[model samples]
Target: MSTAGTMLVIGATGTTGSRTTARLAAAGHRVKAASRRAAPVAGAEPVAFDWHDPATHAAALDGVDRVYLIPPLGDSDPAATMLPFLRKARDAGVHRAVLLSSSAIPEGGPAVGAVHQALPGLFGQWAVLRPSWFMQNFTGAHAHARSIRDEGIIRTATGSGRVAFVDAEDIAAVAVRALTDEQAPNTDLVLTGPEALSHDDIAALITEVTGRPVAHHHLSYEQMRDRLAQQLSAEFAAMLAGMDRAIAEGAEDRVTETVQRLTGRPPGTFRALLEREMPVLPSDPAVR
Candidate 1:
């Protein structure tokens, strides 16, 4: 609350993590940005870190009282890799922790769930961010974005399911508040954009914004799983497709005011986000 000590941000180069670190640093907060490579983050100290390697933990935690927890990517169960460092952070007197989780994976559900369950007992102050599907998934290096850019198609197993896709910047803003606020929310926050729309709606929006045709191709769960398995393990691929199946069942079709309540502003809409980010899509014919 008083904002006295350095804040350690794991996954500092990642989507929300980068934004969080930059925001914290711009606010004049001392920050340690930890990633696998030691690269400078604007207004913050950068350090090399890896979840699997415990040896890189302490240096990052040194002199830090708060942390931003971004779980290991591509790991089905990340708790096994993350808990040990968290335990050490607790012992080292880190008092506040903000974990970046997903709306699809509820607290105590699957990947980062175990870490979410263990947070309350480990630290005096903590918040778990369960953000809906990120809006950036359609514009950034995400698989969907590549498909949209090259093939003019967005593919998923979520049939007609709608999602209130949130923005990474909004999530970072909330995480900054959780780390620095005089009174932490002290509970898991479910963050979303102001509206819910299906993938078809997103494709339509993109088409309108970019003046290029875009389509959402619905795939069977098994088809999606098989497609994903070409790049990922079978188990992880099935898990990802299963999340889409749950969305198709109407799991992620809700909006929340948590972003507004936390950041004193409304969350960014999918259309607005597309207008802002779509220009960055490759204009080069070779990219298509």
Candidate 2:
């Protein structure tokens, strides 16, 4: 499916949004990169946008016909803030929307799920990308990766249950399709990587790749909650621990071909991701 029009990408400098913005621009579509700060993406118009502040919404939606939605972070229920801008976008002639959702959160579940439920009625063309835990969580600017770099340990409450961690690049590829395709899939797409592996397996792979010892520590739900509560609200902390509990219960163990089905290419594997983001060796030979 092929259609061309200006597309707005929220969370413009973020992991998936940056990739989607570059992809759309490279494909010859006009793009509006929206963020709370100026995110001047090459070949795209940059606009300051914040979901909590309705005043920033209109300028971002000015000439866009399609949008890639990344709901406000840290807010348990962003629907209270997001719904109004979405309505405004529709009234301003935006016809399609692609939302970044999670595989753990089903439609009508907590967080972005509320907006996922409301999208269908708001636009004739829309797609909800429900992606699995990101492979980048093990290598990028995530807490798990930070611990790995600093202490050589990956900590989580997920005991032995496996997760099919999809690559953020694959998610972005799917989003491009959802935004530019002539017809939206018009349903929630459950996206996953090619295989499922436990956190221990991920640690082992990192050790193998970096030639440095890495370990996975399994924490109880309560322990994990307490740890996260030090940095986040009690409610949000509990919700995160609960998701880990669900993972331990075998909720995120399956793989899906939705990425390949949409993009005509297999999603990258965890090892491939690791290879691409090779761990940096210390400058001093003694540290290495």
Judged by whole-model lDDT over C-alpha atoms, candidate 1 comes out at: 0.90
Residues 1-288 of candidate 2 have per-residue lDDT tens digits of: 576688999999998999999999999999999999967899899999998888898899998999999988778878998998999999999999999999999999998999999999999999999999999887778899888887888989999999999999999999999888877889999999999999999988888887877889999999999999998889889999999999999999999999999999999999999989866444333321
TM-score, every prediction: 0.96, 0.96
Q: How many residue pairs in model 2 have overlapping backbones?
A: 0
Assess the local accuracy of residue 206 in candidate 1 as a C-alpha lDDT between 0 and 100: 86
Tens-digit lDDT string for candidate 1 (1-288): 474589999999999999999999999999999999967999999998999888898898999999999999899989998888899999998999999998988768888988899999898899999999999999899999899878888999999999999999999999999999987778999999999999989988887788777889999999999999999988889999999999999999899999999899999988889878887343334422
How many steric clashes between backbone atoms does each model show? Answer: 0, 0
Candidate RMSDs in Å, in order, are: 2.0, 1.9
